[model samples]
Target: MARYVEIDDVRVALAEPVEVPPRAFVGRDKELQLCRVAWGISSDGTELVDSSAPPLNFRLEGAPGLGKNEIVYEIARRLDMPLYIVQGHEEFTPEDLALLLTPDPEAVYGEVPPLTLRASPLATALYEGGLCFFDEINRVPDRALSPLASVLDGRQYIYSAMTGMNIGPRDSAARKRFRFCCALNPSLSNEGHVLPEYIEQRTLPVIEIDHPPFEDVHEIIRTSLSPSPDFLVAFTDWYYEQERQDISVRQAVALMNYAMNYEQHVGGQKTKIFDQVASFVVGRRS
Candidate 1:
């Protein structure tokens, strides 16, 4: 007699979660290489061991839609680290950096808890030896930046009011463990926000990226197009020439998808499809 044990259905075995593709952004090889260099400096123990040695910090500044954020994402990806994104804004405060008080469940209904809250997710991640991606860093107020000065210098550590504890005196290992990176739009004469000189001093070796070359832009479109086809590149180039301006490759990919869907349901006419794409691209500018 053969004895057999029942097995769970293979289909019932949960499939590995699909990795979502990162957001579409165009080329920035030079920026990415500089980031890698900074990352290497941060990871090497000897670099930070000497108190006189400067810390490794980077600022990536560029025009809007130039892939600053994407470079940060890619650096974290390549390093196999988690990314914590903090979006900077004009109203950002110290509470946004260190902690804020919140209503504790144990507290009386009318009373607020006195203890400090955990820093923003990004700050906590930075203290915990992870990548912190601060977007639009130039927009944060100067006063609010004081709390981060020590951490940025690699000399001060974060103090969590929630735990009544200091997070660092980062061991050599911890110093070599984490990295901080930021992205921001360059401050043009017309821009309202400006980063303080102190904050500016902390960020070194600024890297700037530009919109990708046409070939790279075309590749981004091809990769993101839902129904991949060889002709997609040619079509995208034509659209770009006709428009006489560049929108994100992401926008182009989206327009292609929308046009394809419209063609299938409305009519297969190429002119109709082109019109739909034009509405998304050129029409937006007008």
Candidate 2:
């Protein structure tokens, strides 16, 4: 069900937060702590006492599939906050970041205006004091990101020219609780995908994320698929033998998952299935 909140004499329909997947999250202790500290969240999962200082907006810079999103999800889980996500792209506009106006389905005939104001995930998070994670933020162009400057800074509000409304938390408490984070592939920070200088300056404390260590990757695969020790041994050998470049956590998990599926449904011999899975994941060995 959609809920509405009145902001600046307009009824803004609140956007629901994306449901966090109930999956086993492993590793990234230091990166997770950096995010927590940026949000002013204590080690024990409580908000810090310094309400005077607003939380810093942080950015996760990494390659795609490196568990950047997972780190944010873990922080949200620990804080027990509603997480709203905005998937960045070239076409995202300023209005898309704040308010989206549409026709009202339930407006009475000649009684109320047909146009309805709908809040974006970012706006909803700002209003509700939740966490908003903008994924692949580098994909958004410079012109589309103008509104974020004020929101990222101490001003802490986004103004919508379409609705003529300033949308954000009205009180200090909600401002203290509101948090924003974004992730991007560092390789994309060139050509049309480069972040604006203002955005770069405001999204403080860039947290660089590389691929996890081999031990953590092993645990991640084990946790995701629960493969036998023999299967893992085979995987370890293959992993090093390839001397794979930029192998992400997602690819590692997918390798085991595809192997499991082959075992269950394809009725293949174990060794052959493992080889096929490896080829599918990392390309055939030269």
Candidate 3:
């Protein structure tokens, strides 16, 4: 059944957790464990004290299309909590965080009903007490992101000026399980943001995701594209040969997808299609 809560007599639906299909999710066992630790999982499988170990709010910094989003999703999948995602953009605002609309009492002949607030993904994540992921966080303007300062720290509450109601710090059973993380994509961060220093200080121990090893990269590509063994070998060989190591797993997958399309539409040799995408698409990215 779908869960809900009452706030100021307004009924609000809680975010629900969705399951991901079990696929050959090629590597990152180490990072996965690290994320688990951040989210309050201990080596011996016991919940640590909050006073000594405050709740972990992670900041994932990496290039665009580097599987940062996937990493968090995997964390949520493991934790078995509702994953609420907020995509940061130039236009993101505090209003966007909590969308509130009052009932038009005059429009209706009967008595006015309670004012239910339409919560944003952030609010939903906070209210529901799950993993809240902010994708491309740096793209959100400072003014829009300022309200988050209260929620990231000891306060853990976002008071929506529009709604005149508190949105977070899940007081229910889910409070203990709530976690938050945000990703900063340097390549795609065209819109600048003055993210508060307080927020940075609050979300401790920043994690950096770099290029994966050859075997893991190949595995990632194989699972993503399912190319033939021969094609996989050639593609990996060519990929590693390049002096620049900027190509991420996501980029490699895109290149292969384009190669497959090229082979389908243009009717080239199977191997040559891979080569064309490498030279054109991958080369341009590099």
- Top model number, lDDT: 2
User: Which lDDT value does model 1 have at 191?
Assistant: 78
For each candidate, what is the lDDT?
0.60, 0.84, 0.70
lDDT of 1 by residue, 1-286 (tens): 2111111211111111113246654467666667767666433212322334444678887777656766776665555565677788889886677554543334457776544233465445644566677888878888887767777875657554444545453355556566777777875414767777777788777887766776776677666665445346446556665764466555555666776776678865554466556666435554
Candidate 2's displacement at residue 82, Å, is 0.7
Looking at model 3, residue 198 earns an lDDT score of 74
Q: For candidate 3, write residues 1-286 as lDDT tens digits.
A: 4355686677765544445555556677777667767777654323433535667887887776667888877665655557788888888778777654544333446766655456677777777676788887788777788788877877777777876887775575556666788888755544445456776676666788878776787788788778877677667666665544677777788787787777668877665566666766666652
Q: Where does the lowest 10-residue lDDT sum fall in candidate 3?
A: 43-52
Candidate 2 residue lDDT tens string, 52-141: 676789999998888999888877777778999999998889899989988775677877667788899998999888899999999997
lDDT of 3 at 225: 79
Clashes of each: 0, 0, 0
TM-scores of all predicted structures: 0.73, 0.91, 0.83
Indicate the TM-score of model 1.
0.73
